[model samples]
Target: MPLHRIPVTADLIRGALDLETTPDGGLVPHRLPPRARARNTDPQLAAVEVQPSGVRLAFRTRATEVELEVRPTTRVYAAAPPRPPALYDLLVDGTLTAQSAATGGDTLTVDMTTGATELTPGPPGTVRFTGLPARLKDVEIWLPYAQKTELRALRTDAPVEPAAASGRKRWLHHGSSISHGTDAASPTAVWPAVAASLGGVDLLNLGFGGSAMLDPFTARAIRDTPADLITLKVGINIVNADAMRMRAFGPAVHGFLDTIRDGHPDTPILLISPIHCPIHETTPGPGALDLPAFAAGTLRFLATGDPGEAAKGRLTLVTIREALERIVTQRAAEGDKLAYLNGLDLYGPDDKDLPLPDDLHPDTATHRRMGERFAERVWGRDGSLEGF
Candidate 1:
């Protein structure tokens, strides 16, 4: 069959804030805009921002066979058991019709103990979807959120073009690794993706792994982006990193919301607290990975900060939740369009049946549950986000 090469362009991409040109003429999708990325210099932030968590190639095509050339860079812990290569999800007309994982690509190994890195380069590979519906329909191929994937090319037996707008509400969400879909079964299985599917909204996920620090640049990116509804999942990373004290946390939250409000004054914004994390629920943190556990081939994390530190206003999940409640209530009384959701409503002590696998991120089933609950609360009839 003859294949038509479709140029990898921004017009055909979704969930990426900017598309940077690669050295090999490919395109690298960025979650953060150019100006924002320039000011920040954290290697972790730079790494996750380019991983394409919610990014995808979206178009309308009648192609029975579709192929995407990808240079996928997979991350591995140097001394830990290898993780499965991330999967690519192909959705046809809003349903998950197919899925594929990269067959060959580069590998980036990091020493969890020392934070050193080594790269083993490998050849590029293809993710193909065959026997797609022959009739013209919407096609979305979700990128591997777990890997750094560069789009080399898109080829199909049938022609492809930018998809017509579906008129769905645009939902912008920013959170930490949990929101970034770390342990999600596949790209589209992330909670936000599932929630977007159920809510009938287009998702622009700003969920970066280990990087949602309430930074002003991130807030500005959200500020400039257009969205009908917005949600901020805070507290987990703050507590895990023990990044700040309660006094600083409140103002940081306010400033983050304030920056977004500058661009979306009337947009419905939901400020969500950290979900139930028993380790950090009462205990404060600077979460530390259990190195011995990892060396023993079992991954685990422990909160290092003392619970007694709360008396000194050191942050914890419980402390942040209370502060968020008061903050949102105060803002609402002042006529702000902000609402609050306890992340526990999405996952809590009752969810012990689906415990976070690594003691940090949610598993596939939990992601599904959270997504469903989020949709019901925000998109269901009489949903808090309904009127907006």
Candidate 2:
């Protein structure tokens, strides 16, 4: 069969927070918009935003085979174990049909001890899928949210056209690595995607790994975006980074909300506190990787700050929950379409045994549970997100 090359452009992509154009006529999906990204200097933020967790290329085709040429930047840590290769999910008419991965992409090596990083560029990799349904249907190619992918070209046995926009509400969600799909089985299996699917909404995930701190630029991005629904899964990144004190946190939350409200005056906004992270639940953070666990072939995190720091106004998950509840209550009283959902309700004491394997981000199963719960509580009949 003759291959038909389709230009890979933003018009064919969805769920990207932003798209960065490349010099080679390619496009890199970014989870953070450029205006919002220019203000942050953190390399971690820069890297993760470009991972494209919930982004996908959608088109209509009748091809039995599809192929995408991608240039991925695989992250590597000098002392850490080798990271897994990124996966691409192929969906036909909204159902997962196949999955594939590419090889021979760029490698970004980070030296933890010296805090230096280097990038060794490599050749583009091709992700191909065969045996797909040979009838005209909507096809979606979901990029890895955990890897940086630059789209070089797309080809199919049949010609393709962009999928029409759906009528579902646009859900703009901001959170940390878990929402960025750090350990999700695939881009679509991420909690936010699952929840969006169950909730009947279109997803625009802004879950920047390690960078969900209440930055003004992020708020501005949220404010400027056109979203019918918005959710801020706050606290974990702030507490883990030890980025703010309690006294500063409340005001920061208010400022973030105020900025978002500037553009979305009455959008249904949900504030979600951190989920059940035992290490940071009561103990204040600065969380660090458990080096011993790392050496033992398991990845784990441990709180590094003194538990007593809470007395000094240091923030913890517990404190953050309380603060978020209070803030939401006050804002709601002012007639804002705002609501609060305790993270514990999503993942609580009863879920202790579930595989949060890393002791931080939820595993695939936990993500499903969270997504289901979120759908029931926020989008179900008579749920908090019922109207608007």
Which is the leading candidate under TM-score?
1
lDDT of 1 by residue, 254-369 (tens): 99999999999999999999988878988998999987888789888989999999989999999999999999999999999888999999999999799988888899999999
Best by lDDT: 1
- Clashes found in each candidate (C-alpha, N, C closer than 3 A): 0, 1
The lDDT per prediction is 0.91, 0.88
lDDT of 2 by residue, 1-388 (tens): 8888877987899987677788988888887777877898997898888888889999998889899998998888777766666789998988888999887789888875466999999999899999998889999999988889999899889988899987878999999998888787888889999998787788999998888999999999899999988999999999999999988999999999999999999888999999999889889889888888777766678899998889899999999999999999998999999999999999997996795777898988999999999998889765447633
| Residue pairs of candidate 2 with colliding backbone atoms | 53-145
Q: Pairing residues by index, what is the TM-score of model 1? A: 0.97
Model 1: per-residue Cα lDDT at residue 316 = 91
What lDDT, from 0 to 1, does candidate 2 have? 0.88
TM-score of each: 0.97, 0.96
- In candidate 1 the C-alpha lDDT for residue 321 amounts to 96
